[model samples]
Target: MPPHHVAWWRPLFLIALMPIGVLGNLEGDALNAFRQSLIDSNNVLESWDPTLVNPCTWYHVTCNVQNSVVRVDLGKAGLSGTLVPQLGLLSNLQYLELYSNDLSGVIPVELGNLTALASLDLYQNNLNGTIPDSLGQLSNLRFLRLNDNSFTGNIPVSLSTITGLQELYLSRNNFTGQAPDFYNLSKLENL
Candidate 1:
């Protein structure tokens, strides 16, 4: 065999020898972590196979043209689990819909890393803990609904920084302090 041919095939051989999950996509891993944490009695997440290259083909997951996860629509899926912090790894994620489930625990502060996020819906769950102040980092967020949960403490003042926020729902919670003034949220249409 020619030296040039050997070099070309060597890389392919090495890749083939790698373990099954070695080349798994980061986004897939993140979503798998979330799946692992959940108790899906209805098998709604049955298609969430971690062995897949990317999570784009998974049920309830949507990907953009670039094959990066852009949306996760699992609302009212009978899922009960704490939201995993690893979900923050999806940098291109624009929508996260996990509402009306039995999810508990605090919203992972790492979710603030999703700078592209446009909506975050976690309403009517059993979630507690103060909303992470880091959520203010989502400059592109337009809809945020955390109503009907057990969230306590004062609303994060940092939330006022999201100038593009159109809908903000903190109703039916146990917020004890006065709501922050969203002077910068001129586009807000809902409270």
Candidate 2:
């Protein structure tokens, strides 16, 4: 090929590889957003170096074989802070375990974007405010533990749409009004 053709192909080649190179960084950016929003006194997140291209290499983050974040095991990590909206960017995330922490603030409505989520364990936190109705969007969710928080307001009626929900825990919250009729959650074994 001519020199001019070679130069043209080089740019195309780089562009083709761009998604692969940038995919990891996008997820890393999402996690970094969470890191920045939190106050980590014990430095359990010390390995979460934003400079790294892949957050999968960071502690407490679990990724799938494709290098997509699937689970975050940061429960009881002695951290506190509001959850960031960017967490919804982890499109493939299935399990979000941030329970037993000092975290406060409303659960981000953006979490509704995690359609792949199956387990969301935020129990035993200081988080307050009405649980976002957006959580009803998690159709794949099975185990949702938002118990022991300061959440107020009526539990979202949309939650009744999750037919696959097996375990739902909302005890210890300050919810008022009649709870949603969960007759649609036929798979529910615990509530």
Candidate 3:
């Protein structure tokens, strides 16, 4: 290839690499925010270095080949404290497994932003407050286990629209009023 051709490809490669760098930083910041909010008595999150380009290398965190955060496997790590809203910034997140922890406080409404989410496992925690209506936006979601929490309020009616949902676990919560009809949830096997 000519010198000019090589130079042209260099700029294009740099442009394509820019977003990955930005995404790495954004995801790193988001995960760091979670670290800041938690009480990691077991030092499970001690490897989460804020200066790192991305959290993909951190323990309990998983990322896709594109370096985008896809899952957070912090279940039963003895972590306590509230969830951070910055976690919603992980646009490509799929499975969020924060279950079986001592995490307290209301679930952040921002969690609804994880549109690509397929499995949301926040069960076995002390989360309170109403489930965010935004969670209904997860059309791709199949497994939603919010059971065993202190969450109150009628399930969001929008959830009934999730035809792809297979397992719905809202039991063991303090939800009041008649359960919203899941008659439309054709794929639901567990309620």
Best candidate (score: lDDT): 2
For residue 134, what is the lDDT in candidate 2? 94
State the lDDT of candidate 3 residue by residue for 1-191, as single tens digits: 77876677787888888985898899899989989999999999988999998889999888988999999898889999999999999999999999999988987889888999999999999999998898998999999999999999888998898889999998899998777899888999998
Candidate No. with top TM-score: 2
Ranking by TM-score: 2, 3, 1
Candidate 2, overall lDDT? 0.94
Predicted candidate 1, C-alpha RMSD: 3.6
Badly placed stretches (over 4 Å) of model 2 are 1-9
Off by over 4 Å in 3: 1-18
| Candidate 1 weakest ten by summed lDDT | 17-26
Number of backbone clashes in candidate 1 = 0
Better model by TM-score: candidate 2 vs candidate 3: 2
Steric clash pairs (candidate 2): none
Residue 29 in candidate 3 has what lDDT?
98
* Residue 25 in model 3: lDDT: 95
Predicted candidate 2 versus true structure: per-residue lDDT over 48-156, tens digit per residue: 9999878989999999999999999999999999899999999999999999999999999999999999999999999999989999999999999999999999999
TM-score of each candidate structure, all chains considered together: 0.89, 0.93, 0.89
lDDT of 1 by residue, 1-191 (tens): 87876688788888887765342388899999999999999999999998778888898999998788999999999999899999999999999999999999999999999999999999999999999999999999999999999999999998999999999999999998799998668999999
TM-score between candidate 2 and the true structure: 0.93
